[model samples]
Target: MKKVLIMIGNIALYLGVFYALLYLLRSTYNYEATQNFAKFLDVNPAMFMVVLFTLITLVYLIIFRIKGWIWPQEDKNLFRAAGFRRLSASRVLLMIALGLAGSLFSIGLIVIDDIAKQFPSIPALVDDLIRGDSIWYVILGAGLIGPAFEEILFRGLIFRELRRVMPVYAALVLQAGAYAYFQPSAALSVISIGSGLIYGVLYLRTGSLWAPILVQNTAMSTIFLFKYIGFYEWFGRLGDIWLYIITALCLIALIGGSVYVWRTSGNGGIGEQANGSTKGGLTV
Candidate 1:
């Protein structure tokens, strides 16, 4: 419980620092000035967040190193503790497949006209990015940087701590809940919980942070790509029967892919060492 409290405190501190940075930026330059700067750089205002988040991640890495979180001893690097390890080529392929299928499946669920109407509308930040002219910036920020940071924080840090004190399944659920709760809106929180679970499973099965990172990055990038290509609009235009058929196909693929990955992950159970532990005294 003490450890969990410390973990929660760290998360609070992290958020505090993030907002402090935002405040600093706001104090340093007015909104109009920042907009002008973004225009000068041929980017949108979202670039500020991209740069700010990148800095925060770097700062956290430095703090981890200084606190012996990354390199606790000569023999054991805590990067492995955070699920940074090599994966088999086959496992990598499976992870990619699951990630893609998961994204498609989630999209299929929300695109149903009834379901879409019931949920809260998309968050303004995401909507702005989708409508913005800077495609590459959105891809770099949302697709890559955002997922990397989230995987590190949620799966690498929070889930690691939870696993140390509870059952693997419980840890997965807790971490997913935490991740979902942090999202900006109810609709996103709903989507996040499902993705968070998939990401957690990927991390555990592959015994590598790269698994979730790759999966999440792929999922996000694909979403942006679909939006850029007007895929959602086109799909919406299709007849209801066709929409249902395609959604069903995506659902089948998602389930089949998840099962295939689980079975192929070998005899390791959810509580196996590969879930979040290293032989060299590293417990992720």
Candidate 2:
């Protein structure tokens, strides 16, 4: 409980740093530009915030290493400790497939909400980004930088820490909760948390940050692409019946992919270490 509390505190501190940097950066622009930029920031504050925080985290890691302050029990290599190890090509493809399915599954929420006459409220920044001409920034921020830092913060740090004290499933749930809390809105929160669960499982099974990172990148990239191409509005235009059918099909795909992974991959599920200790949430 104490550790959990500390983790929550660290999150608050991280958010504080993000807001401070955002304000400082925004202040440099003129009033009209600043207002526009602020809207862009709202589209996905996490994307920009993670850029600065990721750098800060890297520096902290370097200092901790130099001072021999970081725990030695974990792997000495930062990347390995963060689960950036190699996996078979097939495994990578499987991970991506699962990620795609998970993403499609999550869109069901949006369809349902739209039908309920409660379409998810997109962030003003996102609205502005779509209205404007340039979307390379959105692609870069949402697709790559956002997922990279998010995987580092959530799966690499928070989930890894929680696994030391609790069951893998419990840790996954806790980290998913954190993921949801950080999202822009209630609708997004639901999608993010659901996706986070699948990503958590992948990370634990493969012991690779790349797994979750790639999965995240795929999901975000797809959403950004869809949004930019106006697919979201098109989907909305499909009416309740079509949306329900699509959502049902999406759910089927999600479930089928999950079951396929479980049956085919030897390490798709969690395992315990030989020493009866939990390592990478896998049992050996």
Candidate 3:
């Protein structure tokens, strides 16, 4: 319980810092004016995301470095301790595929049309991003930088901390709930929880933070592709039966991929401790 409180405090700190920076930037720049000028120059408002995420990354590094300095032995190279490690080329490819599938599965679960309905602002935001001239900025900030930071925060740090005090299943659920709680809307919360679970599994199975980061990047990139090509609209036109069928297929693929990862993992799966210690080979 104490640990949970501390974890919550940490999450609050991160979020507070993020929002504070966002507020400062918004106050400093006239977003609407800049956006209008950007339109004239064939630029995108999504470029703001790149600046925001880059600054957040710097803040994270500085904060973690200070923590390391205070607790040298236990917290030295905190990111590495959070499972930032390398993997083979083949495994990296596998993770990417898994992430793509996971993203599709998440969409199927929610039904993209329903998502648009439940949270009108979401599709509006995506539309702005997809139609923007600085699409590369969108890709870098939303697809890569944002997901990488989230993987490190949610899967790498929070999930690992949860695992130290509870069973893997409990930890997974709690961390996913934490992820969901941070989302702005109910539809996004559901998607975040699902993706959180998938990313957590990838982190545990591969024993590397890169696994979740790569998978998350693939998932975000895939979503952007789908939105860019109007895939969601096309699929929505296919009626309820087709939606059900596709959802079923995506669910099956997601489950199969998860099973494959679980069986092939050298870390004894999620049953093992976050620190790679094992009491018994208990499967969770």
* Candidate with best lDDT: 3
Candidates 2 and 3, the one with greater TM-score: 3
Q: Relative to the unseen true structure, what is the C-alpha lDDT of residue 34 in candidate 1, on a scale of 0 to 100?
A: 73
Tens digits of per-residue lDDT, candidate 2, 1-284, equal 88778556645655565566556655745577567666655554544544555665665466336534555643444454566656668777766776565555545445556533464464343454344335666667656677777787788767866776687779999999988898877876876787677677776766567777777777666766777777777777777777777777866765565456556655533332212323342112
CA deviation > 4 Å runs, candidate 2: 1-50, 63-77, 102-113, 122-133, 233-239, 262-284
lDDT value, candidate 2, whole model? 0.63
In terms of TM-score, the best-performing candidate is: 1
Q: Across residues 147-218, which tens digit of lDDT does each residue of candidate 1 receive?
A: 877887788777877776678889999999999998887888987887788778777765678887877777
Question: Which 10 consecutive positions of candidate 1 have the poorest summed lDDT?
Answer: 275-284
Return the TM-score for each candidate structure.
0.79, 0.71, 0.78
| Runs in model 3 lying further than 4 Å from the true structure | 1-9, 30-45, 106-122, 229-240, 268-284
Name the lDDT value of residue 73 in candidate 2.
48
lDDT over C-alpha atoms for residue 272 of model 1: 58
lDDT values for all models: 0.68, 0.63, 0.70
Name the runs in model 1 displaced over 4 angstroms: 25-35, 38-46, 69-79, 109-111, 123-126, 266-284
